[model samples]
Target: MKRNYNKPTQGGDVRPKKALGQHFLTDESIAARIADTLSSYKGLPVMEVGPGMGVLTKYLIASGHDVKVAEIDGESIDYLRYNYPELAGRILDADFLRLDLAAIYPDGQKFCVIGNYPYNISSQIFFHVLDYRDQVVCCSGMLQREVAERFAAAPGTKARGILSVLLQAWYDVEYLFTVDENVFNPPPKVKSGVIRMVRNGVTDLGCDERLFKSVVKTAFGQRRKTIRNSIRGMFPAGVPLPDDPLLSLRPEQLSVAQFIELTNLVGSSR
Candidate 1:
């Protein structure tokens, strides 16, 4: 049975390549809700990543926001080009992860990003968002519920990890809501959650930004260990570990500011 991209599939195969993690949303209300999450960074063009069959794209366009999409699926690209002709030159026939995002928009151009993202690459997408933090002012999308929770997870929470700290340092993350598997065509095994992240007020972390990342990742590399043991290898054999009180706490217990302080301490020790 041929699947109509616009309507819900009763039971036929409506999925694109499973490798792409394509699960097209068929519920109009859910799509509209995802589109509505782009509240911040208005006036900037919106880029919809993995706009499979343009379910969410139509709502974004109707919302009067200037929209473009990065889609690598050939069939989906063809469908989008035909359905969303207003996108003319804006339908990027490229992979969102591998695209040189800085070069696509004008120099120093900022934009908002939204999507019902592919679950397989959701973490990579946010890491890419972080890499271009200066340009991507706001990001909102659907992801696996657990991953979404981690993005918006607070310090001292079990969901918090390297990304929780790294992303919190720059963006105000929020887990907006959850969606059931039945809302999608060829529903996935896990439920989904929508999230939004807007840039924060901190312009500078006041430490080696690279070292900050290293510190966060290192501290969580052995999440079961206390900070003192987790980061001990960062220093040489003779250099004593810092006597600070933070060393006693696990990485998840430290806030963003405390991580910065830890980064600075690690830098001084080196």
Candidate 2:
């Protein structure tokens, strides 16, 4: 089904909206390249977050994989439904962040997620994925270069932050390729990059997830401050000033394991 590119008489042209951070990707080559990255997982059901203009959707569907798309924009939904009639029922007109992904698959299997996400909520979307990491084997997305860098950054790097720690704990992140600003219909001011995150097996951290998150957040809250000072409140009975490497180092210097160790230490003392 081919979409009507011209604006409909009932609704005005839904050009890229700054509020929604909608930058429609018009470059076919880039779309194909993004689809190519998913070639290995041909039989898996793929959940695409924002299928703007059906460029990437077309490629995914053609690649012999079952494609389910979640598009928030009404105009894009109309366009997609009109253009790809076969994808009508498959396309979910709802926010990806709120949807229960595991329910979307028939066999109760996880789907590989892909999208050129809205920049405004990219971080939130990632957090959503992390919450349901068990249902996702792999994720590929187009994000602002800075955001992509954070996913693939090393523990001690400038790009490493709360996002890095959270993502790296569960996934092996890779920065694949960079995309220029000119590729979109209404080009964004900044460049974007493609990132792939493959889920690692369940970690054996042996600590409460909530406590681990709290400890990491506290440590990174005042990144420049020493761990001893930053996480003082996390331990009600007072955290022992450990002779470990973490006590002398700043938050950015500590890996996820080190942070988990700190949480375990705090939990043990309580």
> What 10-residue stretch in candidate 2 is worst by lDDT?
4-13
Stretches of candidate 2 exceeding 4 Å from the true structure: 1-14, 237-239
TM-score of 1: 0.93
Q: How accurate locally, in lDDT, is each candidate? A: 0.88, 0.83
Q: Show pairs that collide, candidate 2.
A: 1-83
TM-score per candidate: 0.93, 0.91
**Best of the candidates, TM-score:** 1
Tens digit per residue, CA lDDT, model 2, 1-270: 545455443323456677788888888899999888788888788999988778898899888878989987777887777677769689898999999876776455877999998888999989998877887888998999889998888878988888888888899999999999998868999999999999898656568888888888888899889888887776666445656667778888888888888888778767
